[model samples]
Target: MIDAIKTFLVKIKDQGHVLPLIHQADIQVNLHCDQQIIQLNIKNGGILFLQNLDGQQVKYEISGSPTAMKQLFEGTERLRVLEQQGQLKASTPLRTTLLLESIFFLTKAQNS
Candidate 1:
C-alpha cells in the first residue's frame, strides 16, 4: 500500500507543473488507513517514505479506509467526492486541498 502511494507521488513529481509546486513545499503528510499509518515527507520535488517523523512537524494528514485510499490512488475516486461522502478526511485548508486535488487530477490526465 505504501508502495502504491509512493508510485502515485512519483508520478506527480515527474510532472512538469508539479515540480514547481513541490519544489517550494517542505511538507510532512500522514496517510492513515485504518490501523496503518504511512508518513510521507515531500520536499524539493521528491517524496520520501518515513517510518516515523521523529518529532518532526506534520503539515497535513489524510485518513480513510483502505478501500477509499486505494480508489484515490487508482484515480477512480476524487478526493473531494470522498471527503464529501464522509469516506475520507483531510486536515488541510481549502487552498491546500484544492492543490492536492489538482495534482491528482493532473496525474490522471497525464495517464489518459
Candidate 2:
C-alpha cells in the first residue's frame, strides 16, 4: 500500500513536469490508523507547477481539512457489515455503494 502511494505521487509529479500548464499542488496526508483520522497538511515545499490561461507559470500549494473522512469510512463499514452476513451474496447495489463511498475519499484527495 505504501509502495502504491509512492508510485502514485511519482506519477503525478511526472505529469506536472510534462504538462507545466495545469495547477498542481501537494499536501502531506497524515493518516492516523489508531484514531482513523486523515489530516492533510499542506507543506512548505511541493513539486507541483502550473501555467495558467494567461501563460504565466505559477507555483501551487493545497491545504485542506476535509472533515468527511470519518463519514466515508463509516459508510464503508456499514456495507462491510452486510458483507459479513452469513449469506455472502454479492450484488450490484453492494458494489455500487462501495464505489460511491470510495469516490468520496478519492475525489476529495484529487480535488484538494
The C-alpha lDDT values of all candidates are: 0.73, 0.32
Residue 38, candidate 1: how far off, in angstroms?
0.9
RMSD of 1: 2.7
Q: Which runs in model 2 stand beyond 4 Å of their true positions?
A: 17-28, 33-41, 44-112
Question: lDDT: which candidate is best?
Answer: 1
lDDT by residue (tens digit), candidate 2, 1-112: 2332344345444443333322232333333322233332323334322222343322321111223223232232232333354211223344444543343333232322
For model 2 the local lDDT of residue 51 reads 20
- How well does candidate 2 score on lDDT at residue 50? 21
Worst 10 residues of 2 by lDDT: 57-66
TM-score of each: 0.77, 0.25
Using TM-score as the measure, which candidate wins?
A: 1
How do the residues 1-112 of candidate 1 rate in per-residue lDDT, one tens digit apiece?
6756766866765678756666766767788886777786767777677764455567798899887787677567788999999999999888777766666666653255
Error of 2 at 62 (Å): 16
